[model samples]
Target: MKCSAGRKVFKDFLKCEYSEENILFWLACEDLKRESNPEVVEEKARLIYEDFISILSPKEVSLDSRVREIINNKMVEPTSHTFDEAQLQIYTLMHRDSYPRFVNSQMYRKLAQLPVPNRKGSIA
Candidate 1:
């Protein structure tokens, strides 16, 4: 399946598993990394950390102690790459763990059978 199609499937799977925050955090990090303004980068990085890395956050992602420590240190002066390690970890976790299950899910099977759309938006 295409990466974008797989991403949509995986996101639905994450929602079913009540762990959509993982993908959300990864997407946020991607957006932060594309920022041209240093101030915006710092602000977005801190927000992402607070939302996904802080232990107190309800949406906190599971991360190893080493990565957690790295993030904590970087939070003092947050940068766009501050969450790179953590984001990679989450992405790997989802790809290795959730992705297989998603590919085999009944939902995916049903979606795969649907007719593709044409440029005019009609099913082909």
Candidate 2:
């Protein structure tokens, strides 16, 4: 789940389920947190909201009304941490709803069968 390869596989599986937005939003939030410039933070936050939080977005992730309200309030003056709570909610939702399915998916099974690479980059 932490490794890039594993995340890609999971993302692919999610795409098949039409829920790749969960991982995409999570990744966006991660990128947002790494930002230092306030302007970048605001821009990224707005894009994230327009892309994933808005009801009109095709890729919108499901969120409760409370989280939505919080996000709306934060949008007045966005920051790197603006989406922290919403990110957590989406993370929990994916963990509880999508993760199990991903684990059981053929994509995961195939990944599980792949040989592990050693520090030298050769299959171990």
Candidate 3:
């Protein structure tokens, strides 16, 4: 199965499970890490933390005490990689817990049969 197709199917599966915030948080961190402007990086980092890291947030992603403490300390001076550890943890969680289920899901089965596009933009 194509990685992109699998990711989309997995995200859909996550939504069905009401745990889409995990992927959303991970994607947001990816976007934030691509930022080149210091001010924008700081702003995005804070927003990501408030949206996904804060306990008060309804969209909070599950993070361990060590990663949480690291993020809390790094939040004082936010950087592009401020959420690296947390993001990795979430990624691992999805890869280990959700990915296998997604692979076996009917949605994934259907998606896997679809033709994928080639580099030339034609279906392969």
Candidate 4:
């Protein structure tokens, strides 16, 4: 999330918690991938949005540009673990939210795979 977008989102979330706008954002995000189920997706978004606040409440305005610049400039091996930690927060929240399905679209044995990533392991 960009700082401006985060500002708007947090302001809106504060106003209504889980308003239609928030649900719409969730729905739109869910529409983007070979995605997780609704409950899992909701949990994922909730976790990321929550993590965004720690930076926000600190009034870390400069972090927005720094985060944006780092995100824009990326190489797999050369990046710092701060980025890794933040990335893992996203992954952890997502993993904590999503799971491999118990059944398939065709009753096959396995429909999706959840690879255990080498992540920074977020506790929140």
Best by the TM-score measure? 2
What TM-score should be assigned to candidate 4? 0.21
User: Stretches of candidate 1 above 4 Å error?
Assistant: 1-5, 114-124
Evaluate residue 122 in candidate 4 and report its C-alpha lDDT on the 0 to 100 scale. 32
Best by lDDT: 2
lDDT, residue 77, candidate 1: 87
Error of 1 at 2 (Å): 7.7
All models, RMSD in angstroms: 7.5, 7.3, 7.9, 16.9
Q: Write the per-residue lDDT of candidate 4 for residues 45-71, one digit (tens) a residue.
A: 444334342345322112345554553
**Model 1: per-residue Cα lDDT over 1-124, one tens digit each:** 2487677777888899888998988889889989979899888988898898889999999999999999989988888899999999999998898778776666775788755456797766
Off-target runs (Cα >4 Å) in candidate 2 are: 114-124
Between candidates 3 and 4, the one scoring higher on lDDT is 3
Computed on alpha carbons, the lDDT of every model, listed in order, comes to 0.85, 0.92, 0.87, 0.35
Sort every candidate by TM-score, greatest first: 2, 3, 1, 4
Give me the displacement of residue 74 in model 3, in angstroms: 0.3
Clashing pairs in 4: none
Which of the two, 1 or 4, has more TM-score? 1
Q: lDDT: which is higher, 1 or 3?
A: 3
lDDT of 2 by residue, 8-100 (tens): 988999999999999999999999999999999999999999999999999999999999999999999999999999999999999999999
The 10-residue segment with the lowest total lDDT in model 4: 99-108
